[model samples]
Target: MEFADRVILVTGASSGLGRHAARALALAGATVVLLGRHEKRLDGVYDDILAAGGAQPVIMPFDLAEADDPRFNALAATLAHQLGRLDGILHSAAQFIKLSKLEHQRLKHWEAAFATNLMAPFALTRACLPLLEGAEDAAVLFSAEEHGLNPGPYWGGFGLSQAALIALAELFAAEHQDNPNLRFNVLIPGPVSSPMRHRTHPGEVPENLPKPESLLPFYLTWLGPQSRGRSGEVIRPDLGYDPSRQD
Candidate 1:
């Protein structure tokens, strides 16, 4: 129970990387606060955690793209009131609107992409700064993607927003470099057999890609005590991280 007594928030807990990360964090003994727009899906995750003997999870149904400052502040206030402290945050929520050319990308698509991928994280993190800083050791994990690191054709706003998300993580780490309690880093879970991958690459065989569960170790290491003092990094497990070895 590396994360025993810790409280962690996971956005996009309805599906994909976020859902898997939420369950993994809870299993490792963290009280997982599942945040997403889909109430039913969040309930499923909450039940899964209980059935697996993990900590009881909280379901917070929220639309990331549409959330405003008041909503973000209220979320922080609620966490502070209920959880007392926040130990970690996994910004796994994302918005993707298919593969399209830069010119073909609609204004609304860009707005939604940046809102969920970049703005929401910024607002939430800002609101929860005091709670995170209050913890003995707090970590924030921002999810990035291959297209964000290396922008190519047809990636559009989704790629750009994620690229900004990477920068946001770096900035957070740099700003708090002197603070011993806080750490921020980005994780790039590449080509996993996830819903997003299927939507982006319809022709690809799902069996060929690693299952979402395979990336749990990476999430655990980053969000848990194993990653102490590790900040401002863009970690790519698919690139060369050896999960078999200890961090």
Candidate 2:
């Protein structure tokens, strides 16, 4: 699963699954563009990649929640001027403020969640499509959540955003199904011991759960050449599920 000359963008690259994915992708020979709001944390990941002999990564500190279409377009322009083309994008940034009932949820929190988890990906992908289309084979991966798939009480904004992301991925895939160069897929990294998971399930023993690194193989499979023809599939690695099975 080598990405010798590939250029990939990973949001939320300062920590958790995004950080781990950036490191692994760098190790796999891809020039990873790390995007996050925290400059200090982004530098930490960048230095770690350098220390590990991985390709020197680029850091783009930006807040997804506040990013408007113009900002997204500017980012796309910058990437185009610098990298010329993009091989893939892993939409790993997310916002999970708390678990609350819809009635009690603050409108600001709801808007923020959708902005980061859904709208940002949609706009970012839309902006990057031209760059992706220029690549020989390109992929866009949307992070999914189990609660989004099977919603229950108290899931509220975060859950709704994720569910919308699933639909968004499907819609993008269907729209581009005839385009041999581009593909989109959703990945649900279930029960990973991420900061988001820790906040969501505080009582769970962290040691019992898989770390973010546990999803690397699946990441490579989806983002690299191996997943070229696949599109619009929900990939749930934790369940050992096959994409062929609709249910």
Candidate 3:
């Protein structure tokens, strides 16, 4: 197992990209900490991993939108006490209410979007910086969106928050460019068949979209030892990877 000795924290592990990636990482031998809002859903993922003979996973039912400095610090401390090291983080948690016109979006929507999509990663990563730095090698992967890079109407705060998430990742990389132990990067999973995609584009056929499992190779590449020293780049797997193979 490539990650047999690694401890990786995966946000949004209850569903979507986070769920799939956590499963794969665990199977690859990483001790996965599954963080999500729903304990039952997290348990589902936890069970799935263990049933497949993957490494045992920790279920953390946490609300990203409500995370603060104290909570984040406590989380870090707990990880340190229990796992003792953090080798990687997959920031796949996101908050997407619905696609609406700028005027139609509410203040709460903006708040929730920024909190879950941008601020949570910032706070969590900041709190865990020490643990990550202490490791011989560490990587932080942020889940981004293609629309975040090229924004359009109706995407609203969700889009804006994703754009800012990219900037956050870049800034993390720039700040740690000289640190040989750490790397930060963003991944944009484009047109994948996910619950979020189905919610946003109900009219589109799910069968036409590439399955979420197809993006696992890209995620694993960044989280595993292969992408050492690579940081600050926004990766769109659809660009270089062939989607037809998934068919």
Per-residue lDDT over 1-247 for candidate 2, one digit per residue giving the tens place of the 0 to 100 score: 3898899999999989999999999999999999999999999999999999999899999999999999999999999999887999999999995987788999899999999999999999998888999999999999989988977789988888999999999999999999978899999998887888889988777766777777999999899999999999999886342333322
Q: Lowest-scoring 10 consecutive residues by lDDT in candidate 1?
A: 238-247
Q: lDDT at 85 for candidate 2?
A: 79
Runs off by more than 4 Å, candidate 2: 239-247
Better of 1 and 3 by lDDT: 3
| lDDT of all predictions | 0.90, 0.91, 0.91
Tens digit per residue, CA lDDT, model 3, 113-212: 9999999999999999999999998999999888789777999898899889999999999999999779999999888888988887787777777788
Runs in model 1 deviating more than 4 A are: 239-247
Better of 1 and 3 by TM-score: 3
How far does residue 43 in candidate 2 sit from its true spot (Å)? Answer: 0.3
Per-residue error for 104 in candidate 3, Å, reads 0.9
Per-residue lDDT tens digits of candidate 1, residues 1-247? 9999999999998899899899888888999999999899999999988898888988899998998999999999999999899999999888887898888889999999999999999999999999999999999999988888887889988889988888898899999999977999999988787888889878777666778988999999999899998889988876333334322
- Note the clash tally of each candidate: 0, 0, 0
Candidate 1 accuracy as TM-score: 0.95
Pairs clashing within candidate 2? none
